[model samples]
Target: MFTGIVEELGEIVSVEPHGEAARLAVRGKVVTSDAKHGDSIAVNGVCLTVVDVEDEVFTVDVMRETLNRSSLKSAQAGARVNLERAVRADQRLGGHIVQGHVDGTAALLSREPGELWDDVRFSLPRELNRYVAEKGSIAVDGISLTVTSVDEDSFGVSLIPTTLELTTLGARRQGDLVNLEVDVIAKYVEKLVVTK
Candidate 1:
């Protein structure tokens, strides 16, 4: 579990493939302060277990399934990633519950800067429309943000300065791909309602 609260913006230091699998190494300060081998870390919205830790860099294996489902398929060295350590038992729930399981990926459609913040619009996959709602929570590229509004094809979110400075979202360009995780509660509710 994670809060979508990004601890620090990390860089993909290296990516090496072996047969059908690959190893991903990420380097960051805040997130590696107490990390150990076998720990779980949310890298760009994907929960990966740590297989190795050296200095501030840690590595995880990327299975074929993970690559196919996320923007990580195109991840490369020097790419900026949002990093979050697994939520602890005694920690406060600053953000909504996030499983770090990406439901899908969204494409950035446009961006509009405002005096105090910026509003970003992302294409909403038709299959995920029912699970997203205005004012509801959504995780984009591992950063938890509220849905400012929703439409037939996409949704929008307002980004504060802090969010802009601390996450990869600040650098998102039009047409960029981002990982998306809808509210888990919403998915469960929809399942029950449709089955009735």
Candidate 2:
């Protein structure tokens, strides 16, 4: 599990394609500080296992299912990815609970810069709309952000300067694809209500 707090902005060093799967070598220093083989790393909201680690670079296999579910299908060597290590048992929860399981992908619709922040809008998948609410937390490209507003088809998030300079959201352009993981608690509540 993760807290949806991005630790470092990493770069995809290389991508080697195999049949129905691909191997990605990502370069991240901070997240790899104590990482070893089989450790989990959240890359753009997708939980990937470390297959090999060498010199601040780690390799993970991206399966066909992962590629199909998230924005990783378009990931290439030069892509910038938000990276976060798994949350420890005794650590504080700086962000909401995130399973690194992306519910779906969203497209950047527009961005409006404010005096102290930027209000960015993204298209919301219809199936995921019920889980998103105004003032609710959502993980966008692995960075936890609060929803400023939400419509039937889209939602907006206020990005502070720190977020603008730290994560992939800072460099995201209009129409770019981003991985989205909604709050896990909301989903669980919905499931329990249905079963009750």
Candidate 3:
């Protein structure tokens, strides 16, 4: 598990095909500082195990199912990704419970900039619409953000200057796709209600 708090903005060093899967090497100094083989790290909201660790780079394999369900399918050598280590039991839950399991991808609809913040809109997937709500928490590209508003087909989040400068969402443009993970608590509640 993770807290959806980005520890560093890592760059994809390379991605190579390995039969039906792809091996990805990411360059991140902070996240790889103490990383070891078999350690789990959240990359753009997807939990990936560390297959190898060398210096400031760590490698993980992306299977076909993961590639098809997240934005990683189009990942290139120069793409920037949000990186976070798995949360420790002793650490405080600063953001929220994030399983690093992406529900789906959302397209960047638009960005309305302000002097100190920006309201970014994204096209919410129809199947996941009911799981989102105004003022609820949503993980976008692994960064935890609060929903400023929600409509039938889209949702908006306010990003402060810190977020714009520290994470991948800052550079996202119109029509770009991003990985999204809805609040797991909401899904559990729904399941319990239906079963009851």
Q: lDDT per model, in order?
A: 0.93, 0.94, 0.95
Q: What lDDT tens digits, residue by residue, belong to model 3 across residues 1-196? A: 9998899999999999887789999999999989999999999999999999998999999999899889999889989999999998999998989998999999999999998999999999999999999999999999999999999999999999989999998999999999999999999999999999
Residue-wise C-alpha lDDT for candidate 1, range 1-196, written one tens digit per residue: 9999998999999999977778999998888899998898999899999988888999999998888788988999999999999999999988888998998899999999999899999999999998899999999998999999999989999999999998999999999999999999998988899999
Task: Give lDDT tens digits, candidate 2, residues 1-196.
Answer: 9998899999999999898999999999998999999999999999999999999999999999899989999889988899999999999999889999988999999999999899999999999999999999999988889999999999999999999999988889999999999999999999999999
Give the poorly placed runs of model 3, Cα more than 4 Å off.
none
- In model 2, what is the error at residue 42, expressed in angstroms? 0.5
The collision pairs in model 3 are: none
Worst lDDT 10-window in candidate 1: 15-24
Collision count of model 3: 0
Clashing pairs in 1: none
Candidate 1: where is the Cα deviation over 4 Å? none
Stretches of candidate 2 off by over 4 Å are none
Ranking by lDDT: 3, 2, 1
Each candidate's clash count: 0, 0, 0
